[model samples]
Target: MTNTALDQALQTLERATSTPELVKATQALCALNDLEAAKPLVKVLGFNNPAVAAVATQGLIQLGRDTIPILLVSLDARNYGARAWVVKVIAALRDPRGLDLLEHALEADIAPSVRRSATRGLADLELSEDAAHDQLVRCFEGLLKAVRDDEWVVRYAAAYGLEQRLNSAAVSAHLAEQGRAALNQLASDAEGVRVVQLRALKALQRLNAG
Candidate 1:
């Protein structure tokens, strides 16, 4: 799509009411493959309507890593809703700094979802060394509780933490039963845990190379 066409689609996104129209607009923009489109798309971060925010978040994701810095900047938004979405965006980014920001948010942010995401992002990043073992243990304990959270995202993220930390055989075995259960649940159920769990499983699987 041309720049003019993409701009026209974005305008339609602004006025769109139905899901299909917004999807079409996003598809056009995504096909353009310009991450810069996500810069303006960040406005959707603050969109008053939840549905609009959801759509905008989807668009921002289609922009991929391009959205990470913008999402990180948005984490400081005064609005809790925006911050929560930014946490999700950062988790989606799952880049190196992604977990670092999450650690910062875990220590400093007030919102539960944001804190929750930070913990999960820490798991996703899988830090090395015993430097933060104290914090990791504490975070994993919290995730233990999260593994059963009514919120599926929270529950699986907790499990994902288990998946990432299996290198610490001591730590991995501590929750071995729960880890198996989570992966079992994921395989038995649908949509709750996916690649994060898979990645964690691979991490654990590799530690036995001895």
Candidate 2:
């Protein structure tokens, strides 16, 4: 589509009162892949509509690295829901630029859901570790800590991460030690909510079977 055509479509998206109109505009913007669509797509992430949010996220990911700087800045957005969505986008991109931000959010974000998303980001990353293995160890340790987080959802996410990786042949001894200890503790968590403990127990079961 031409730049003028893209701009008009985005304007229609902004003014869209009905779902069909919004979806059409969203589809147009996704097809356009113009840099100008980044801000509007980011705004769509904050919308209460899940369909719009999914479309915007896919569009932004298709736009690729151009969306990273905008997303990084948006991490500071006042709306926690938007921040949560932005983190998921960054996680999907798997850009190293997002690693520090993801780690910080995991450690400190006030929102459990944001922290939950951050765990997935950290889990799926392949960081360039130094000789001391700080980066790799940090990622593992962060998941370990998150497995015991106050929120059951956060714990569930952490357990999910460990569960998926329990049998990987490539796991280093150090990382395995960290993951196993954390999983074992989570598996037997006396005070955790039933679902959280169940996830932990399942992860441990998977580990044993692996």
Candidate 3:
């Protein structure tokens, strides 16, 4: 928010022509969470500039749980990198509050990459609660939509989430059929996706076996 910080973020954005600068600036911006402090970086997400958008999202990851709500609600941002980064930012925050947003993005996002990233991030965060469990179950049931999604990337991600989160039978019973459907769908996809799906399916089988 201060002129100095704003200048710094602006400079960071300017310097993002290289990958290392992009990573550093993003990490620096994460430390500055004030909306004013973050807005310059956030605005870059909306830029017609893809490099700016990419760097800002990387910086957004440094934004902690306190910053996730802003990113999550920006679900309507037209920039693919912006939407994709919101998922990445939430996942980077890795907080309980983000679970619901991650679930929402996973199910409702129109972008295949955003949906896939959110589902994988949600699975990575391991949110646990009766409420989280139920929400995850609902997320799993709908994964069939992604499982059958025209994009193999989304299908594989949905399958991976189901496999990772089936930690309890309470949730597992509901997902068993859907998980199977995802696996079958995975099989029909490209070899790269089929490989990921097989790994995800193998994870599910291991969990079920245990």
Candidate 4:
């Protein structure tokens, strides 16, 4: 598409006064997939419209690594909704630059949904062989702690994260064992939510099968 199309979309998004207008504009911007649209999409995240924010997220993810710097700096401390959506975008990108933010969100974010997304993001980070050792340890430690989160969703995500980390060929045997132990604990937590326990059990089974 042309820059003119992107410009029109951005104008529409900025001028939007209703949810439908916002969704339409955001969808248009997303379809453009222009790097110039990166900042605008990030701005849409704070619009407080889930439909619009979701579309903006898809647009940002479509922009890929070029959106990383924009996203990293765009974190709004006070806007939990925007932060949550931004975390999802960062997770989808799986860029190493997002690791710190993902870890911070998983460990300290007030939103369970954000924490859950962060858990998956941390687990799915694409670490190079040289950087995998320390970064993987960080991811594993964060995910292990996440297994005990107050929210069942976060715990469930943690179980899946641990399983993913364990499956990585880059994971050391020692780290793999620790991850398995964490999953085992989640699997047997009779007091925990049944869904979470089931997720943990499934993670364990997958690991054992591999």
Candidate 5:
């Protein structure tokens, strides 16, 4: 939490107007890993410049769990891009406190990026041995719904998630079976895009190999 790097980065960010300069300052602030960088990075997520926003997202994620609370606050920002990137940051942190937020973002009215990221986040969840069976079932059901999502990217992410679920030692037999059924449906889906079908096929192969 040294002020030197944050102080310099803040000065640079304050003076930065161009995309490159903004991105540079954001990266610098992110590398500092100071709590002060959290709010700045969250604010940058709403930037009109995509490059700056993208770098801010990476920096915020690089800051790891320390950025979670600020990000959760930023989640309420009006910008869709900011919300979507915050979903990704929250997912990367893997803290269960963000789970309800992610699930809520899966609504159809939300942006595709947000929904897709939330889907991937749900798929990445790891439950403890003592976790409730209903919780596991709910997660499994979420993934199943994701696999059937209208967006191909969402389905692709879900297919990859199925592979992880089937391979996870923490997942229950019943949940694994559910994952298998979802993958099977995707693999045999005649109307599905070729790339997605291929992903489903690969997931099935991995399941069989395991």
Candidate 6:
């Protein structure tokens, strides 16, 4: 798109004072998907409008790792909505740079939704074969801890994350075994929610099949 078009979209986003205005502006900005739009798209996460935020989220994800620094700098602990949406974007991007943020969110964020996204993000992290052992351990331990989270939804995401990690080529055999044990425990957890149990069981089956 032309600089003029981008400038117009940015102006629209800046002047937006209503949902429709926000949606239309965000849609225009997202359509451009210019790196210049990254900061403004991130700002939309805190607008508390799901439709507009969804458009911005897709825009940021499309922008990919180029947006991580902006997303990281934009995180405001006091803004739960923004933090949650940021976690989701980080997760979707699966950049290794997000590891620390994802782990922190999983462990410390008060919002279960943020914790859940972080859990899944940990599993989705794209690590090199040469990635540090401690980093691998950190991811494993984080997911392991999340399996016991008070929120069932977080636990469910943990199960999925553990499964993904267990299946990753980067994971050590020892860690995979540990992950299997964790999934087995979750699968047989009679007191656990049926959906979680089933998900854990399915993860175990997939691991075994591979």
TM-score to true structure, per model? 0.58, 0.86, 0.70, 0.93, 0.88, 0.91
Number of the predicted model whose lDDT against the real structure is largest: 6
Clashing pairs in 4: none
Candidate 1 Cα outliers beyond 4 Å, as residue runs: 17-27, 48-51, 126-160, 167-210
- Comparing 2 with 3 on TM-score, the higher-scoring candidate is 2
Cα-based lDDT for every prediction: 0.62, 0.79, 0.65, 0.86, 0.78, 0.88
lDDT (Cα, tens digit) per residue for candidate 4, span 1-210: 677887888788879899998898888888887888888888889978888898888889888998899888988888989998999999999898898999999888998888988998988988766787888889988898898789999888898888888887877888888888888888894636999888888988887888
Candidate 5 runs further than 4 Å off: 2-8, 128-134
- Candidate 2 C-alpha lDDT tens digits along 96-174: 6777888899999999989999888877765553532565566677788787688988888888888655565666887
lDDT of 6: 0.88
What RMSD, rounded to one decimal, does every model reach? Answer: 7.4, 2.5, 4.2, 1.6, 2.2, 1.8
Clashes of each: 0, 0, 2, 0, 0, 0
lDDT of 5 by residue, 128-204 (tens): 45654655576677788888788888888889877876776767877787788888888885636888889999989
Candidate 1 RMSD to the real structure = 7.4
Identify the superior model by TM-score, candidate 1 or candidate 5.
Answer: 5
Which stretch of 10 consecutive residues in model 3 shows the poorest summed lDDT?
185-194
Quote the positional error of residue 194 for candidate 3 in Å.
Answer: 3.4
The 10-residue segment of model 4 with minimum total lDDT is 183-192
For residues 75-177, could you state the per-residue lDDT of candidate 1 as single tens digits?
A: 5457777777777777666665565577676666767677677667766653445545555565465555555555555555665666665545556455656
Model 1 earns a TM-score of 0.58
Runs in model 4 lying further than 4 Å from the true structure: 1-3
Candidate 5 clashes between residue pairs 3 or more apart in a chain or in different chains: none
Greater-TM-score candidate between 2 and 4: 4
